[model samples]
Target: MKIRYKRMHLRWIFVFGLFWLILGVISITNDSENYFNYGYLIASLFYFGNYFFKSKNQYLTFEDDIITLNNLIPKKLNLVDLKQIKRSGKDYILRTENKELHIKTKFIDKNSLKDLKAILKNLQTN
Candidate 1:
């Protein structure tokens, strides 16, 4: 199974990205130096990191015995070796002996989270 981030979060990310881009453009047009534009450009990096540059993709999937987190680079963990799952407010933290995965619930819809819980339960029983 594969799950995606919430559309609402993506919408906000797009809006923020456009705002920073506009700021960068305005700075370039109003100021003789483009140095002021650098701040806006740098600020836009946050949006880039979330939506584009840092991650080629962001999703979770299960196939056979491995679970994969497909983001930036793909990460796989053994389903049989799963350890702990912790919920903090709206975030989910999955920890194994030497590795920890942080999943932001705000970025995922309620239905996805519910499905994830059911998946975890199955992983636990097996």
Candidate 2:
């Protein structure tokens, strides 16, 4: 199963982007200094760039005996090797015999969290 990462707090980003775009246009229309207009434009573009990258690349997947942390890379982890599951605040910490993985809680929504918990329980049973 594949679960997508939540685009946490995206509405705020869209609002900020619009704010910057409008400010930028107003500054340009009033013949403001080049620095101010450029700054607002850059801020808007930065928000858009963040939207572009974050909306696609993060997800969690369980396939066969391996669970993948599809965040920055295709991290394949064997379910059988997992030793402990720990939760700290709003983050999840998974400990294996060799390594530990920390997953931010914001990455998955409440429903996805339930699915992830079920998958981990199945792994623990097996």
Candidate 3:
């Protein structure tokens, strides 16, 4: 199974990048001497770059006995090695002997979140 971040949330990030880009341009044009404007420009680039990469690449997948969260780096958790599962407000925490994975509900697609909850519940039962 594959779970992805909400499309609406990702689009909001793109919008934020655009906002920062426009702010940077306006500041640069209004006062050429200010170096602070460059920060906004840098921030805009960072957001834009991440928005594009994350839109396509950010997801969680379960295959065989492994759960992988694909972000900037891929994180893998073996189901057999999972020691605990806990639900806290809007997040799910999966703990192993030395590692913990926090799955935040807010950014996940609604249907995917439902599926994830079902899977986690099943895991808890077993």
Per-residue error for 19 in candidate 1, Å, reads: 0.6
Candidate 2: count the clashes: 0
lDDT of 1 at 103: 68
Error of 1 at 119 (Å): 0.6
Over 1-126, each residue of candidate 3 has an lDDT whose tens digit, in order, gives: 888889998999999999999999999999979898899999999999989987777668899989988777888899999999988998888999988888888889989988998999999999
Writing each residue's lDDT as its tens digit, candidate 2 over 1-126 gives 766666555556667888898898889888865666778889999887666655654467777877777644567777778888777997777788887777676868677788887876766676
Q: All candidates' lDDT scores?
A: 0.73, 0.73, 0.89
User: What residue runs in model 1 are displaced by over 4 Å at the alpha carbon?
Assistant: 45-49, 52-56, 73-75, 86-90
Please rank every candidate by TM-score, starting with the best.
3, 1, 2
Question: In model 1, what are the clashing residue pairs, if there are any?
Answer: none
After superposition, the stretches of candidate 2 with alpha carbons farther than 4 Å from their true spots are 5-8, 58-81
What's the TM-score of each model vs. the native? 0.74, 0.67, 0.85
